[model samples]
Target: MELQQMRYVLAVAETANFTRAAERCHVVQSALSHQIKRLEHELGAELFARTSRRVRLTPAGEAFLPAARQCLEAADRAAAEAAATVGEVRGRLSVGVIPTVAAVDVPAALRDLRRRHPQVRVALRTGASDDLTAEVANGRLDVAFLGLPSSSRPTGVQSHELARDHLVAVLARDHPLADGGQLDLADLSAEPFVDFPYGSAGRAQTDHAFAHAKLTRDVAFEVTDAALMAQVIRHGLAIGFLPSAYLQRAPELRGLAAITVTNAPSRVEYVVWGSPGPSPATVAFLATIGLQPTPE
Candidate 1:
């Protein structure tokens, strides 16, 4: 019933081991076990099944875990709101970002957020579009900024369109076609390709573009890091496709040429948020970063 006891229960449920959970919670193992016992005594039900080899959540534990997390999140939000009322934004907001945004925008955006709301904290996690979307849907993240399909959208989360980024071909400086102002998909059909993983949304856009031109690329490598792919392109190992933003801040891939594919598709970057809505501190941080909500 106590908040600290609830935290202990949630930590044990998450780690599935008293010893590991204690380490995570910065407490001793015996103390963590004692708190869990107290919590189980109060509820009059066993929350976990334990053995020397492993610990697994019982049915009651499984049902209680999410509710515990929600309670903690709500409590944290309430505390943040109290702080905000005193002209301070204090709390952590976890954000999932795609590579392009991390490369081009996050540094400046984070700087602005920090200066404007010194007490507010931001944690960033980066991954491919599908992975980021899944995190947002699962309540693992407060918000996500990534390039997504224009036709599809986040199902349970709210979304806002931020900007459109063009996909262009990245080629080695020494390549003959690098000097070309614009290159068609047909022009790179036979070139060795460094591309996104096949199932990724970015890959889908790349594939769709090639299909439209009736051309297939020779993919020599499939990579997820935009900057690394740019490096591979720079070394003449393969040609790659990426948002133009990749080269703007990438130090390893300087002087790489991007030829706008006349027939290529553009990707839209959106900001998606989970339920429970943004805290006042999070709202203040977002406005500071120039991503204010649209007027009704």
Candidate 2:
């Protein structure tokens, strides 16, 4: 089947509406539908089951989707590689980051990448460290910025350590323990906490520290967003832990006190990519962030 036909099929499968898919592909609905019908005929099976109100992928379509995506990606990468040889980088770069990424200025890096290689399209997403790392390893993301407890490192991917720092205790200005003194794990154990979800990499650092110190704490609020965590702390609903750099960047959280924790958990920030190596766009992005890939 033609690559354009595959593209049409993918668009239909993703949008699940022929008209919307046509709009996305910048083609008229009839043209897109005709191409999909041609492709289905060539493949000897219908790709979609359509009704007056809904369009759903048939079993044959489900089987064809993954290979179609791979084929498109391969074609794109080949074109990008050919361009790279002529001193041009042109491709899509999918990047992932944790909500509290602090080691690299992601927006600034994206700006530099745009200035240096305008042909490279960039897509950015924020997620938990483990999920981002998995996306990078699985080729869904070209690169990811992650943070995990000092005792852990990313697996199944190539990684570079970016920075390491202890997490500080964040408390509202009016909280009793907001006296700006260095506190240990035990000192904060009695206080309710606002923290990342229990199993997330962001929460693991503090959980491990508390376990190590033999202290039990209550997580009154479990939030996925760092800004929400800050708000929870600011309202005195619960205290939390965050990298000092993250706290410094959030002006709204300026009133919150970040206290030094004598036995605080530490985390390492890393930049990770797939094991096979980086695409040209990925390479340019790494360089934009001042990180050179390690030689294999």
Clashes of each: 0, 0
Flag clash pairs in model 1: none
Model 1: lDDT equals 0.79
Candidate 1, residues 1-296, lDDT tens digits: the string is: 87788898888877878998999999999998998899899999988999998999999989888888888878888999888888888887888888776333765776887887777778888898788888878877877887865555666666777777677888898998998788788888989998888988877778877877787778889988887787788788999877776556667667888788888767777777765566775576567556665423
CA error at residue 113 for candidate 1, angstroms: 2.5
Say which candidate scores most in TM-score.
2
Off by over 4 Å in 2: none
Model 1 quality (TM-score): 0.82
The candidate that wins on lDDT is 2
Which 10-residue span in candidate 2 carries the lowest summed lDDT?
Answer: 287-296
